[model samples]
Target: MPSAWLSTHLRASRPRVLAALNRAFGDIDVAEDAFQEASLKALKTWQQDDIPKDPAAWLIVAGRNAGIDAFRKKRRETLTAPEDLEPVHDGVHPEEELTLSLDRSVYRDDVLRLLFTCCHPVLRRDQQIALALKIVAGLSVDEIARAFLVQPKTMEQRITRAKKRLQAARLRYEDPDGAERSARFSVVANAIYLVFNEGYSASQGSELIRETLCEEAIRLARLLVRLFPGEPELRGLLALCLIQHSRRRARLSATGQAITLEQQDRLQWDRTLIAEGIILLEAALRKATPGPLQIEAAIAATHTRAARYDETDWAELDRLYRALEIIRPSPVVSLNRAVVIAKLKGPEEALGQLEQLAAPLERYASYHATTAALLTELKQFSKARKAYEAAIQHAGTEVERQHICSKLDALRSRVPGL
Candidate 1:
């Protein structure tokens, strides 16, 4: 995964180089082309020269030279004598002096600027996320596809369409201000979270979870936090991720099976992450910014605090979900809301909710399995058997299929007629 490390470093520096080149050259195509040229040079240069002390500065210099060289070559092709067809810089501009002092434009706001550019108005939201992850985050097509729980070729087409949209609309590349930046920021966050979630869940990989991917997402979130310390929603996001990450070790059983939240070993959770999550969540809430992430973090906090499953604050969790629903409503949230109903109201009331969700729930294994589990708990063995069979039918992985099979066997054992 040396490429992974290199990619991160390179991606982190992209904005810096792109921003500087864009500022100096005043053209998006010219700046982006120069950044690509500089990246190639880094591939050749960094290995042989011990990696420049400031890689960003190195990239900026290389990119600037690239832009200048490209302009000169174009002029020669036109058979026109050079007449100051290059960037003119004023002497003593601190920015220019800083650019001079650097090994590259590593610290330049170019990467952020690049993010703003990729999520421009022309691109569809899904396409924007895909393209940004591809170009700015340095994720491969497979990686981007896995992130979105879709096929690689599908993601490839999405990104292709995104680029076409940007070209067709001729999207501008200047650093965006107030509203533009805010809108773009959401897409960037969603893209990064999507990457982290794929890595975290590993829907197709051998491992059920990849801690490194989660860590990478956490790192990205932290970087965003540093870039905008006063943003409460950002703090909520960071807080939510930290808390969930803290429970990773506790999530699996001894044989690597997926353990339900009610069954996890709380003792194995990372206190460091949990503590940090709590602190961040508190700070965010102090600003009264009650976003989805902040609410989710509070739910996680409630889980982390409980000494045992019986002690879990299901009532409080139910309340949190209710509040979260007010802010953001989805069938998934409604499904979760039913869990609280099962715990507090009764299996029948919860079953009503499940039945209400049948249109959306029919294809999902967890939805079927959860319905079956509730039936089993209610001693409705006949109904439970049917639900378990459905779970097996739709199960995405062998592990899930096996789990459902076990549930079916238990339900069959309880049935007398057969």
Candidate 2:
């Protein structure tokens, strides 16, 4: 129990722990390695002695000292073991040490600085997510790989390459400003959303949702909102995450299979999150800037508002999707808009829109899945079967493949065709 508690504490405290270590050591890799070493020490020591009053402060001190020793050893310089450092006597507060460890004003906030570092522009989006999950969100390589639908070794290599790229860039631990700051903010926000999306509908693995990734993204989004309190888009981003995550319980069936939105039990949703998300979205709309995130949040809010599937405001939802399409044009956006069209107009119209997307979305499993769903509704069972098969081939996870197989089998039984 103590170990589990310590593990949870370390994970929650990781950003601060890592930021303090980076402040002392000046290398992201060193900070991560030092924090890991300190975590091991805490597992051994906390069982005997009571956990420190300030665990983040404790981890920082322990990790910083470990980093210094490692750095010395790496360069073949003289080493001062942690045992040689001054020990805290019984009931003596470590306030001064904590102050010295974290008293840096180089950035507006340490966590934000660490986020910027992880989401450095040099690394690709996947690399940014991998590095941020590793360094900022405290996810294991295997966990991140599961979220990304990649092998553990592949994720490990990706994180390694990302770190190497960060080192080569020689990025500083300072808050960005000016045009550069705006660009970095966009990158950071996108990376956070990507993390949330991965968790919302895990690209791989048996689980329909990975709560850790979703929680981490929300945590980071909350931090960003605080850092930029006046930014409407950031608030919209937070609202979107809140509303989407509210359905976590309803997103999967009792047997751990994906449940479509129409089948999800709205009663199972988290009202607290929905209320908070609505409040946030309301505030964002008051700003009148009308950014892409706000539009998307509005779309999510529409779904959250409906008491039943038939009660959904299809007309309003369709308009929101069209607005989103204009703001951010892409094949995926078009596909979503088509789904809205199906709900509003008819399956025939939606099918026509989907046909145009084939050239762009041929490799996308969701495109095939959506097309298959529309075709099945139209009673074009043979065409639906082909689409379902294509979807199965491109499915990202075992659960997805199984879901598509079930659909295909149902269609085959009804249609009496290959």
Candidate 3:
């Protein structure tokens, strides 16, 4: 009688319950412990019966009650009976129980407030990301470590240190205001972007895409927008995620090979998501102060609007990349611009632009892949072969490596003596 999607439901509801516990207990350590206790109860109860109608509310109320019992035991200098710690389930209505347990307003901003805390400036960026994934996204220690290409113990330590630092800082659970809120907003936004990118391309996994993680990132971005409705960048971030994720169906071929954008079947893309992304981007643009996310969303919009690859407005894309470089100069951004140049001008021009990037992008697999493509187009067979070999060495996933190897084989067949 257990629901097949019990894990998914638990993950989705964790943030709400954990956030509420943190607010009620006013301590991250106690909150995490109480939520775990409540989750065990749900695991036992939901298997025989159906999952609660309001899972988040159920977990929140149960966790709050459990945390209160722990406090009572601690203050009394004795352990409370295990039965006394269990959530009340003596035929009480779930909603009625939740309503009597805690005020609804306690959780209205719970997730957002938790996000701000995890991304506080005091923690290192890596620590912030790990904490957010564990606390907010409900990813396991091993899952988070796999995403970071680190050992599970390392990630565990990082999270422990981050929590300890937060506890030591004695930061309260309250909504930030004015400039502090703006700073925290940017930090939280960047962390969410990192989450989406890892899911989008999977930097260190056999699977080219992790749809669940991508969906989680999008969900978090939407939550961020609701919390900070006036922030244009949050809107842009959500729009960018939706537009990019619309092509998930076309990102890999039927045989699990990586597919290039030009070769992907356009019909496979999600039109509804594309339309919503475009609307959001247009609204963000009307604000007149374009952040990096807004500019990136505009560039993605340009691609989604084109009916066919040939119809793509490369000239305009070139302009946007130029603007992006001026705003945020990154080797990765420059590499993207090289693609536009290849389309607008020619391989020779694109190759020239790419050469200067070699040093900065020495270890980047895409740098080698792009170079190989441009070299192949110019009939520089020997150099192209080397670049393809390099790309294979640097490739993150098996699919990417296989794709590059296939290209190398095709080149060998075309030029008999190579």
Q: For residues 1-418, could you state the per-residue lDDT of candidate 2 as single tens digits?
A: 7678988888877877787667666788888899989889778777525777778777777786677667667766555444633333223335356656444453235666678788877889889888888888887888888877678999999999988888888776554566677666667788898888877874365453378788989998987787676778888999999999999889877777788778889999999999999999999889887877888889989998999988999999889988988888889989999998998899999999999999999998999999999999998887888899899999987778878888888888887756
Candidate 2 lDDT score at position 80: 43
Order of models, best lDDT first: 3, 2, 1
Worst 10 residues of 1 by lDDT: 86-95
Off by over 4 Å in 2: 1-7, 37-54, 72-92, 96-107, 145-152, 172-175, 206-209, 376-381, 413-418
Writing each residue's lDDT as its tens digit, candidate 3 over 237-313 gives 99999999999889887777878889889899999999989988888888887788988999989998788989999
How many clashes (backbone atoms < 3 Å, residues ≥3 apart in a chain or on different chains) does model 1 have? Answer: 12
Task: Please report, as a residue range, the 10-residue window in candidate 2 with the lowest summed lDDT.
Answer: 84-93
Residues 135-191, candidate 1: write the lDDT tens digits.
Answer: 655567887676566788898888777777766886555556777666666666666
Each prediction's whole-model lDDT (CA): 0.72, 0.81, 0.82
Give TM per candidate.
0.79, 0.83, 0.82
The residue ranges of model 1 lying beyond 4 angstroms of the native Cα positions read 1-15, 18-33, 40-53, 79-96, 99-112, 116-129, 140-158, 173-180, 208-212, 253-256, 414-418
lDDT of 3 at 30: 88
